[model samples]
Target: MENCPFCKIIERRLPADIIYENDRILVFKDINPAAPVHFLIVPKQHIPTLSDCHEGHTAILGEMMAVVPRIADMQKIGVVGSTPETRTGGYRVIINAGPDGRQEVYHLHVHMIGGPRPWKDNK
Candidate 1:
């Protein structure tokens, strides 16, 4: 876990553009963003990936899922206003599970993406 980049960020061993943090989770802007607004939401604990999750992780996972929408709103990526031109109207929430899924970081995290333009491939 010492080499885990997200763990380092959670431990303050590394710096990140943190948007939210609590005893259980940490949310920060992705260094290499795929969208105009792209951030990573990670658990404070070191879980390698979704595959590593156990029954004991259910509550935490629930909490993380419950918070995603709230955090997305706070990030102006969803449900903040009604204007069709607003970036908050539509966004994509993605969780890449492993190497085959394009997950660069071994730690489990969800990517929240939105803002200007639809995802390139969607076009």
Candidate 2:
């Protein structure tokens, strides 16, 4: 954990475009976004992956999931309506594990992405 970039960010040793921060987690924009809107919700605890979670992690995991809608709303992302007529707004949450899962960072985190598809190249 000494060399973890996220840890440095948490420790204020690195700069991050942080959007949200609570006692238990930190939310920030992804450096290389894959969608119109993308951010990472990371637990303050340095968990390596979902598979590494145990019974003691239940509350933290639950807390992590509980804030998804709040984050979406903060980003002005709309709701996910169940019916075609009511359909609106959208977002996605992803958790990659281990090497096979294409996780670039060892710390466990959730990726929340949404907004219009075919994101135009902003650069």
Q: Number of clashing pairs, model 1?
A: 0
Candidate 1, residues 4-41: lDDT per residue as tens digits?
Answer: 99999999999999999889999999998878888898
Give the 10-residue window scoring lowest on summed lDDT in candidate 1: 81-90
RMSD to the true structure for each prediction, in A, is 2.8, 3.0
lDDT of each: 0.86, 0.88
Worst 10 residues of 2 by lDDT: 114-123
Q: Name the lDDT value of residue 109 in candidate 2.
A: 92
What TM-score against the true fold does each predicted structure earn? 0.87, 0.91
lDDT of 2 at 12: 83
